[model samples]
Target: MTVIKGCRLICPNNTHDPILIPDREPVYVGRSEATRCIDPRCSRKQLEVIADWESGEVTVRQLGLNSSAIDGIELEKDRKCKLPKGGTIYLLVGMYPQRVEFTYKESPKSPSSPKTENSEKKNKEKKEALKRPASDHTSSNPKVKKPRISSVQGSKSHEIENGSADKAVEEDEEDIKQLEEKLKILKKNAAEKKFAFSSDSEGLLADNEQKKMTSSGKGKRGGGETSGSSLSKTLSDGSSLKKTSAGSCKSPATKSSSAGSDSLNRSAKESEGPPATETKWQPFEKLYVCTRKGVRARDKIAGFDIDGTIITTQSGKTFPTHSGDWRILYPEIPGRLKKLHADGYKIVFFTNQLGVSKGKTTIEDLKTKFGSVLDKLGVPAQILISTGGGMYRKPAQGMWDFLCQKANDGIKVNIDDSLYVGDAAGRPEKWATKKKKDFSCSDRLFAMNIGVKFYTPEEFFMFQKTAPFSLPEFDPRATVSARIVDPPSASLTSKSQEVVVLVGFPACGKSFFSKTHMIPKGYVHVNRDTLGSWKKCVDVCAKALREGQSVVIDNTNPDKESRQRYTNCAKTAKVPCRCFFFTATITQARHNERYREMIDKSHQPINDMIMNTFKSKLKVPELSEGFTEILRINFVPKFKDSKNERLYKQYLLEK
Candidate 1:
């Protein structure tokens, strides 16, 4: 045998580089002789191998190139020939003469095996058996014979005696028919049971049909009868049933059809029972108002005054007073009263009417007129009238006490929270002044003295409608206390660092005071005129306060009601508040010479009449009632002297 080593071959078509195998096992086989052969038809390059008997040598037959254009080549060296390209290379191992001869032999054919032949025969037999007809159970016989038990019960025996075959066939057929009938009955019973259990009969029917198709032969007639009886019992016990004559009509279609009829009859028998009842409300039930203190107050009592308060008389004929007449509810008044009601404040018109005793108006007529006025005003509550009596009249507190006793049934008022609003004294012209008539009546004064918080119509209206006062909650006691503690002064800087509100007639030194005093003293000046230019000035002021800045409002805050807004704002910001009234006398105001200049320079025309009206209506800041501080500004000589710095310093220091 010859072996080849260290031989290489390369093919042009092979894209991947070949792996070089060194020290690989060589293979040898017997051959007749060693021959030199070339296959030109082969696409692979030809390589040659030569054998040497002496020294066990193998040589390359032709090309000795290290690399070749050939696709693959075989080589052998020493013991056996090696073709690295071939998966397994062959070598001739038998001994041969120096001149060896080669010969080729043909391969022999293989004989058939018995197992294969037997399997083929078995398959042919199976095909023939499948092509044959099925066996028949019936035979031609007049007599009805009994069925062979083995044949009917699926036995392995295939044949029966001719005498008994006919009987066996007949018996088998009868058994099949019975089984089918039982299956149908079982199916019907299952359907009825399913329908009884389901809320929807239509769905139950569909499910039953599907079940029957899937479980055709498994159902039994006896099982169906038992299931049907159970279903009937369920339906008869007040369970829902199809109520119709159709339900009661049993068809031979199913055994449960008759049971359904019996259930329907039972349901009809139970339908004769009595029905259920309903409820109603009791008489003498009433709605009452109760305080957080557990005090129950009167529901509808309202008191009215007779004099200039409720009735205004032109000459002799009596008519409703502007302040007294409920007919002409001020635009801002209704909304305010509604808000008070929403906050649980009972709205009762408390007034002292003495005209009945004076014989100016009869009690009956007055009541009728008052009732008409209240109706016109849409006052839905009841009215309590106290007339003629001296004790129950103005400045006496008798009338309020009487009404309270009657309405409250002796329940004392939490006086601190109650409010009294009226126009004038019990006698209107009694307190009239030379320059102006006193709108505050004696009754009003009495109410005020008795500690009832009094507010004029204008004051109440303004406070109710505007910001700050429009806040959802307020405590008058705290407000009055704060006002009494820190009275207003001309000096901007107070120990409390309170917010000062400048209020008076338009252009009546409000803005001037704010800019001249408040701003210079590190007080924040919040002018409504400036704020009015922007939509959300109050919000801006609130923000500044949140950041710890005190604010002063510059506005025509003529009424106590208007001033209340600023006071309330101060309260909300947890800051003290004061009111500064620019109380310049008419003489000084007209002669100052600056007034005309201001009027001329003003963008809005200042009507003198309107200005005077506003000034006259300006309510003095009620420091004892609802304000932290109140200051009166008077015009003194040298009020504007540029060199009187000492006097200015003195005023500032004293304030």
Candidate 2:
């Protein structure tokens, strides 16, 4: 028998030809046509396999975003493991399994250790036993028990005594089919190699040479039967085979074959597919919440984001191609979640799915997708999904608040022990190898708003050191006050009638400042929102000034042209025009707007379009824009109640 040198990688489902592992060199395996791996989640260079013939081992390194496994042990990205002669390697969470097989030449036996008469006689008897029919051998063996299918209640009693015979039979048949497929493959390769020789005489000469070497070498190692014949006999007696505790099917003569490799063990169940989950998710206010069976609300909470954190698109896409297009982000996720559950921490997944509100995906589909993920994790958990923007969306503590206040069954959460893990931590591009910049900082901000510790997915799952990240410039937690006006002696009102135009972005405290400070001083308030248009506001301002009263224009007079309108009005009315330029940034205004939405539901939500439009048109109110005086008005937030003040201090922008 000829022994092939080095290791061979055989992906039974993906390719018929085995890939030869080059000695001391890395061979890349992935979705590339060369590797013949069609799994979409497999990257072009998903795995790096380095074979060492001298050591009889292979070094495998994970290089892709998804995870691979070696003999059931997880091999994560940038991590490597040494695999022995016959070990199975799984790509993308136990899919596309390829077994590495190391081949070696059998040492020849010495003629001085010739077989004795007794050993020769035993060998002849073993050959005769192999030629006997399997049925006759089974009937002759006293230890083998025949299945009893009786009439009346005897059949039911027999089933209760020995378990389901039909299931056992089905498993045996399946195992036999797999074994036959391997045998056929081996035969096909052997026949191809046999014909490749120059001539029949050369092939015959090689066979005679092998026989002489075997006769002159070490004694027969096993039952002296070829693997092909041994496998055929095993399949013929498949009905008598029993599953061992290790989940392998074996017969008494199974040890005769030297071909007991990892490929046979590949039939071990890797995944049973996603478990069927019931739709138990219920709507709580604006959040879609689901508590898996056996989950309990605990003091310590382990919160995670659904997308990019727990699971990712199996298609290697940013967005999923379908509802079922997803896989566990890392192989360690399930084990870690289980550990957290054992530590009395309630597992929770917080996700913002604005597309649900926009009709991109249905709520039922999201529920199914989430259910599949939870099922794969095999742990009891709770999921909170925010379908639309508002309090429930991340960067707002609405979901956290609801979990503590409404859900949790009245149990108080210990913020000190609770921490959130997500991918969107405001990390810049190249924060890690091949890591892209996060789309938003909502996860980090959500943890900040809930006053709990936060961690990115890499830090939590991979146990990596904290990476550098930036937060939004506007810190709502800061309570120290700054100067209300740029000039220390700037007065709120003048003794003579004057036109005061508030120049700032919307929600920058322009309306509040005019109503609180100017309106009570006999100055007529003018607003575009109230009067409908800028023309109407101008008319109202001119009318108030014509009556010898001071007018306060509370509108976002952003550009020089808009501020010129009010300044021209003051000039025509023979009064001084002053610009109260509000020095508030766009981020601060956005934070204030969201705070208002939370406190007052009637306050219309200001979208990014409105804020961006104001920013684009802004030219910075200047003394050159025909103003008698230009005073900078700083935004100083005030709260009526202590609860409102607490809420105001929480982060509101996603950034």
Candidate 3:
């Protein structure tokens, strides 16, 4: 197949900039001048469909768009070499922002789905098996019990148990038909009852009106002067018996009021009927999606992570070396992707571009690079750019959910058939070889979060099968299930007010975990970052200690020198000081630092220099640091909002 892409503007609104058109067939481009503005002299039928796909003869076709005529014209009809004049022929595709180009590139045709073919072969095998005698496959053991059912029912049961294709469909159809019948009966009964109730309500309303009129008429009226005088005398004598009894015995008015309320409620329920069963989702456009074309519903979905999984910097830099510095990791990548496309899978590329969100990289650069790569691969694809760390980022379900709901053309994705490819497999470092592992396991967790199959690029594309990789100390799901080992003096620490110091490098999840656990548990937190100095932290700790409050000093106390200040203050206050050592690796800490720097701007930023300085000075906190107790504080990541989860992990195609 050959694809033709447009590079120039063909519409007044400049909607069409770069458009892809496969070179296999002639493409129709038309316009509607009625709804949109078009130059009066411009032709309504702007473009004629004509293409040459290396065939001896070229074909041409004209299609109408909302009454506009497209002329049919074919060039180089005979096999002769007619080098026609070629430049930019700007054409439009109706009122849409799609431009047509004559330039074409060769591409591969889409192949049939592998799943469909496999199912057909399986069906043939099943038919052959059914033809054979059951005794042939039956166990020789006499104790083996056979199912107790008639031949017809037994065969159906066997089909259901084995999950055969046709029998399952038949059973499902029968079940649906029965449900429809039941629904129809229910609707009929509801309609009849509503109609009867309406008739009864009309009579009740008239009766209520009559009762109101009769009750109003029977009310005793004070008769002229003599009755007024007598009433005054009776009131003076405190004989208000008649008026009290009459007020209490107004049963007709009360009954009418009650009946009216019941009728209104019944009418409201009848009109509203049962609530809608569907839970409507927000439109796909409402989501945070930077999208590319070539997306639609498919049985099999091909999901891939962008940056590391698809393209890597040729310069071997941590970030992008330059705009065009990226090169495909493996030559096999394109072939693997092309196969997925041919096999009826909608290819989608998902990337968390934090730099774009942080104003370091523009979305246009990402689009251009992605377009170039996809063009090189010669495949139509879908690209989802998660422009920020929140909600739509990896390890979150927003992107996956939107695709399954809206982008897939309302087709429900079969999770078993779909798989995600990414590079962040959380492999631990082999220090002896000086090899570093991945930043985090966000990709694997993203797959886990969505409940789909996951494979690293090496395993899937290069067939590098090996042992499973390691996971980080942090588990997003198990954040709440932290195993809190008691301090040596557990009774004193829990019940008595004492000073606690957190020791770790920057972005090691010290402050986050403390906020969630410590502050809520009546532990006052003292942070040097917020207080502006270690002296202020000490002051705050001393004041809290004086106030009989247990304080937690939340800071990256890198070494014994930094930790001694807090321990000394606790000792001066006659309080036991305990150290909570954060147990995340340097790689994890660096990953978190990068995530904070690029994605979340709200938190204080940690530069590479600071991270390096901390690493150089990092010392494990021992009991000799003058702490009464040393507790291990493992990293635990928790997200308050499901849509926005931790996203510091990088997806790399190569280790």
Candidate 4:
């Protein structure tokens, strides 16, 4: 196998002798003699070049404010590109071009192979050849030639160096004029093609051009393959489109020939529809956002929920039957959206598709469905999909935060002018014609979280009167009670050993109250979660009371049957058993549960099904159930900082 022994940077103008590229170390190319360029437009540290001898490739990273081109493709600041052998790097777009040259040598099959006398002589000659200047023209240039040190005096050498520097500067000025002309020609061609620059996505490659480059790159050549053979999205401003909350949608029609060819073929085989409906959606963590082409950022944003407000299942089922089983919800939706766009409002769709996470549907299916919907709508918009229960899901502000921070192209949204329309406004059944109760209240709470005006599909498009609806019963902004005990005279801690059983809904502050008030007071804490069973909880409580210690049972001992085991354990230990019944309502408990999910991400999410099961099994604790005393414990929330207090006060639960 052949391997690279050395590499050099060759200036085409013969400004100086070929500069050797140090192996495995970065060399800067800028306004310095070390790089053989004195152009003032180039910064002190413009391009960083590193050569890998094993791979026989040079890596060029842009570090300066000015952009550089590698193999005719623009390389932005902080972006790195691999330069194959014979690839050229143009500093400042066609000024001071440097071509890469590699020297190769054949490697022996094995280290044990014996070297012959003839082979040793050839190796010596090869090493000497590698040390000499790469090209004959470099050594022949009189203006850039080095003065003979032994014959010439110091002043004569200094004068020669000054003359060469002056000549290079003069040539640099001429190169600048040529660069301006090239830029003008590029702008003229772009205008002729009717191509407009977009901040999010730009520099689309033509299919024919990409095919031509790829076909030519497949053949073996003495110089090597160029990296520019692949189609790429290059930004004119040297800024990258981050895979953040805001993202640019991929159009299947203009898919890159280099990378998307295989996927496009697979998509064609998988479905028998318009290939243009299939877009390659990229995931940003848990959120999947696609901002289609022609979507422009504006101060006023008109947001809508996807499933019920914009589209409904054509199969007349609660869930979609297939990717194509959806249609526009109302006839006026298209006209309303077009009017908003004309009024300078950017349309955005936010939807929660838990089916994707549950494996009922894939991201590819959702992308195809979303693309088709946009095509039918005939208006460009951005779609945000939250596939699971997380910060990005509706009722949470992850999607809205992404829009404000990334999707708006740095434009600050005017919340007063912006509005959101959705069917899930917490309306009860019979609120509209043949209407059933909405599935969830996440959409309404989503708008509330972002402090935007909200409407339903009928209200926004058909001019229907605002109907009566209900919000969550538990208001997080309500002032919390300061009194910890309802009776006010009940003793928090007993002088003797006792077992305190807690009875309330899940997330009613049982664990928090136990850890805060009882644990510090020498009460042993027993939880079913840590023990993994109610039997273990009873056993631990029995042991604690037997050891003459008070125990706080931190489980949601809702029913009398579940609470009897602990009471029986206390009876065996001859200790009094008391019940601390939390005074929070079920709605208030659900609110607290969501608040914990937001603040402490590690806290396991308690979904609606689990909460509903607890509600059905609940049998409010009574003093008749072998409890010596029953105290009503009020949940008084305390915060250490104002930031936390503000976050807690926000409405977290939709229902």
Candidate 5:
């Protein structure tokens, strides 16, 4: 038998056949080099060695004729051919026949050794010994039985029958007394032993002492082989041994005392742990926020006006007066609406669309257009158009009532705490020349009537800047600066009554007075500094008064021309208007000398010239020009009076 590492048998007739011959198993020599026809019945033909296996080289080749031809081929070692199966094959390159045989050897199993057998026998003996009775050794010794209680009990019963019960009882009493004496010694020794053991060890001293007490008590109850005499001996030995150990352990006691002190110190230190980390409690800082008066914290309702308030649309347009018709979002409207939404305000669009009832445009078209506009701006609001015609629009309580009903339907809004933002009349009035309808009657008046504070977008932005309602604390020493200018044309009117013009040098007290007093009284205090454009200040003041709002021009209206602009606004609004000018001496004006100092300190050379010019032109208003009223102000005396006494207590009370 022979084993060949690499060799492959070939069948020339079946080129694609995968089946190997069962009966004709090929013998692999060092290599296989035979081209044989697979069918035994085929005719003989000249054969050639197909594969070879040499020292380091192995190869295979095909040399059979056709499919049906029989080839007498024998394999032998010749040149080695390295087959693809990773072994060598021998080819009969010299044409000599070499026979080979194959064989296999089986591995033997290891036998058990003597050492293993002896260990098994030893384990069996120990197990058997463990099963033996404990009493067997004692039963063989009669002398041992004399001292045992069980044997003594049996002997006492036998002795009682032999007339000796009294002696047995006396012996039992003696044993008990001995046991009591032994127990006292044992407990003392155990305590001393525990003390010694604990003194030597730095840790677990208290724990070990506690454990010893528990173990000693349990041993007495269990009544184990530790006899009373043995317990006493153990106690005496333990005590003496503890004394010796205590000396050696004394150093550890100092260490242990430190350790125990450290332990108790640790225990107490552990008990005290981290001093609870003394969590630094920081006080909550209250943030400053501006809010409207009479507004409740829980109120969520918001009312918005159509027309100029939300869009730049006016009447007589191509579409109906509906908010959707030609009314696009104002540039600042989205941000305002978003802020209101975040603050939990339920935005509701309230508008007076009389055009719809008057056949100007269909309601369906208005809704469609309005919906589209809302989609674009990403604002969702409930639209309430007052097409019922009879004063249901704004300032009328009807719209407010409707809103209240909606709030009751889980809208989460407080009608009383809500705000109305519009640009119309808040109340009706009759001028000597004509009867004027309240423009804000539909929205503004309604809001006021319903106890909701009203604001125009302009006023809203203005209040937003200074947070006047918020009443922030001011630093007296802090330098403040502001540009003084006229109000917007849209905010002022001629028919307006009681114009209050605030005048001061840079940072006296003009703006402070206007904001503190005039605003709360529905006065249109026109500060030119608040206006975006100074050139349009007069026009804005005129427009505001014309709209029937009392105007207060916050500017240095020292000359007549500037004062006349405010008077004209009052006249146009068909209401009484008067110029209340602020007056002070040069010394009083120079009280704001810090502003002059600031101008000088500034790097700009132009500021010095501008400040000089402003100081030169500063003047008090003249009583000429047929003014409806002229008021002279002594600011220094008033300021001193107000400071000594609360200003709100006197001036604010009158309003």
Candidate 6:
């Protein structure tokens, strides 16, 4: 790999100095105190070169350059890129071309393998042949030695040293016009070549035109490939699209000679479909819809979670305060999506932003930011944002169901090809950003609900296998059919009038079971949600017991203290109190909550805090808690007319 030795600052009276682009930290280039380079001629923190130390992949971004005059870096195009090895990338600070040169060097260790030894032999010969003539030219010139020595260090600095021998490229006023014309032609040809070879493979190949980049800057042959490449939405169709250098989306009409052409053709066949229905703010269950204008509904859908998956704050903080404080997380994200779009997958973004409903951020601001983000991404996509909590919130399939049934022009999604990727994968704390656990296991549950494959942002974007996700304890997938809990021949007496104290989490099937089975058996129902207090609930139960009628207390009697009041009331009435323990797991309870909230408008949404509270305070019920009879009530699946064994299906869509 080629290494950059120094940067030439083209300011009057300033001697040439070495500017090393170090790895990892953001190497600031300008007149700021914090910047690595302090050039009075350059603006404060005008440009930043972010480098990965190991691979030497450098991405240069403009921070506060006030002018459009800068040539290599473009604010409009977001021209930050991985700097090619063995080449010079010219960025204009004011009007002069700031040359960053990669110098060839001999490693201390000899090559081990025969192939490597042979390759190294060829490289050494090539370097010698190029340098052999240059040494004579510079020795005769004499003037090149001092300027080059001060500007670059080590044995490799000789080649870079020869270029500044005239001491005129950076400071000579007379050569400015000549340099400007030459630089213009070079930049134009380079831009054209970059546009033609769009992918990372082609980007490296674009260096072939380096001979024309600058008549002064010499080109060296470098052997390598992009060391790291990473993911979202699994693509099994064997379809792909070649991205352009400017990273613009080409109509499926543009054919590429690259290998991706086969994938692109395959994608066109997959994407062929009726036009998708385009609508913004199409209301559904207190949620708003916004589909990208030109997107079409296809059999295969590539769903993504927006914020942490697609974009992150440029500030490097976990959360962004302003709408504009965001950037595309990975460059591969755009390229991959463009390919997917070309291949025929309907790309959709499903995001939940509670801040919108809480007035921390406005709907208009979020929508505007989203529009700009998509515009910057330059891909057509359907968007579903659940601003308020309920069925539309992730972990529930309300948004997915809506997209499949209503938004997609009546095309049923193929779950085999469909996949979802999100950052809220219930991962351990600080999985992506420091000091941040995933907000919930909602994304995984969302995919599970819709019967599709799931992936975390790290898995999808960076192609990394993270530690096993800490899944929601209340996964409905594991909670199967509910078993009927028959009493041990004691509580089945038809004339017995007893108080049944139900026990479980908030969303447990206590109330549902009470209404469906217990009510039919002449048991009067009493609940805290309906009566407003447990005291009132106990009073209602007492009134019912006094009337010689059975009563079911349908509140989450989580611990001994909460259950004590109800048990004591029944004992005072001289009735044999029955403890009906609803044996639904947390997963089953959460599944029931999600289903009820989305399907039935009359049903209130179950808060996470309430569920957590019950989970935290829960104590195992014993016969010691003053009960004559204890019956284990296993969750029994109930559907109005559907017979699908998958209970989650009832809440999602009509089978």
Q: Which is the leading candidate under lDDT?
A: 2
Greater-lDDT candidate between 4 and 6: 4
User: lDDT tens digits, residues 66-157, model 4?
Assistant: 76765434566786778745667877654577887888889886653356765776677545534444342143433232433435566767
| Residue 448 displacement (Å), model 5 | 1.4
lDDT tens readout by residue for model 5, 441-508: 33443554555677765566434321112111222222322312222122222333556555445444
Residue runs of model 1 more than 4 Å from their true location after superposition: 1-326, 382-384, 409-411, 425-436, 464-655
Candidate with maximal TM-score = 4
Candidate 6 Cα misplacement greater than 4 A, ranges:
1-271, 274-285, 410-412, 430-436, 479-482, 486-494, 524-551, 558-575, 585-587, 613-617, 643-655
Ordered from best to worst TM-score, the candidate numbers read 4, 2, 6, 3, 5, 1
**Candidate 3 CA-lDDT value:** 0.57
TM-score of each: 0.23, 0.57, 0.44, 0.58, 0.24, 0.52
Error of 3 at 277 (Å): 32
What TM-score, to 2 decimals, does candidate 4 have?
A: 0.58
Q: Per-residue lDDT tens digits of candidate 3, residues 55-172? A: 4232333232221211101111121222122312323212233223355466776676999887777777545543444343233312223334446764877656545544454554
Report the C-alpha displacement of residue 511, candidate 2, in angstroms. Answer: 0.5
Better of 3 and 5 by lDDT: 3
Task: Give lDDT per model, in order.
Answer: 0.42, 0.75, 0.57, 0.74, 0.42, 0.63
Count of backbone collisions in candidate 1: 28
